[model samples]
Target: MWGRRRKHRPKEYFIFGTIQEEDRVIRINPSLDQPFVPLWFLRYVLYHEMLHSVVPDETVSGGRRRVHTEEFNRRERDFPSYCRARRWEEENLARFLR
Candidate 1:
């Protein structure tokens, strides 16, 4: 599932994407729904959130929920253009805040 759009609030930290696991939903930040954002980058973020739905979460000793385990990270790199998309985010994230 998808398509929940909302405006970003001032002083609110940015979130590029998120997954609601129980609902099996993936949401892309409305800021990224622009022509300037590459399609590959959008796909990368959507894919990342979708992974949270399929990948099993780990419960640690303190009963902490760990979403991004080693295997999850490894699988994330399998996405084509992963590195390029991440680099693009690092370089241009500030621009999206607008």
Candidate 2:
């Protein structure tokens, strides 16, 4: 992920990573590239984005795309440090917000 200037905003929402399915490209938020950020946490975010490639999105009613399907979440939890990674995110989210 490449760093770029962004407008300051509240910490109400944040996206750790994303994937462009058509281009098969993954983009992680540059905020996660900090000294305090753990490598395992970074890997977890990457794994989540990579999962998008294998787990198909579900087409819900009205044709809305459901990116994180039940199957996707199930597989995500299969990650070795899923719980720990999530806990770390919750604890360290404020760092990225700044």
Candidate 3:
């Protein structure tokens, strides 16, 4: 449940965080290291990644990998302060992109 700051990347890269299943680690974007970032938001992102560790992967009819399955979304909503975290992300996305 720890995240490390990564090198600054352009918004075009559109990368945030990634979970390495093999290593069980989360690599976070450098933009998230700003002071404006709220703890709840960080917790939300971490929780989302942690969920991936427990949720089983899904395969569609076309054999496509569904990382965020319906069940995953459902469980995500169960997180305390889910709406608040999502709203904060939507409102502060530009700052992260900067």
Find the candidate with the highest TM-score and give its number.
2
Those runs of model 2 whose alpha carbons end farther than 4 Å from true positions after fitting are 3-5, 8-10
Predicted candidate 2 versus true structure: per-residue lDDT over 1-98, tens digit per residue: 64354677457778888888788688888777778889999899999999999999999999999999999999999999999999999998777765
Residues forming the 10-long window of minimal summed lDDT in candidate 2: 1-10
Candidate 3 lDDT by residue in tens digits, 33-83: 778888788888888888999999999889999999999999999999999
Stretches off by above 4 angstroms in model 1 are: 1-12
TM-score of 2: 0.86
Candidate 3, run of 10 with poorest lDDT: 1-10
Q: Write the per-residue lDDT of candidate 1 for residues 1-98, one digit (tens) a residue.
A: 34556654654466888887577667777778779999999999988998888789999889999999988999999998999998998999788666
TM-score: the better of candidates 1 and 2? 2
Candidate 3: stretches off by over 4 Å: 1-13
Better of 1 and 2 by lDDT: 2
Question: On a 0 to 100 scale, what is the lDDT of residue 98 in model 1?
Answer: 62
**Clash count (model 2, backbone only):** 0
Error of 2 at 12 (Å): 1.8
10 residues in a row with least lDDT, candidate 1:
1-10
Error of 3 at 3 (Å): 6.6
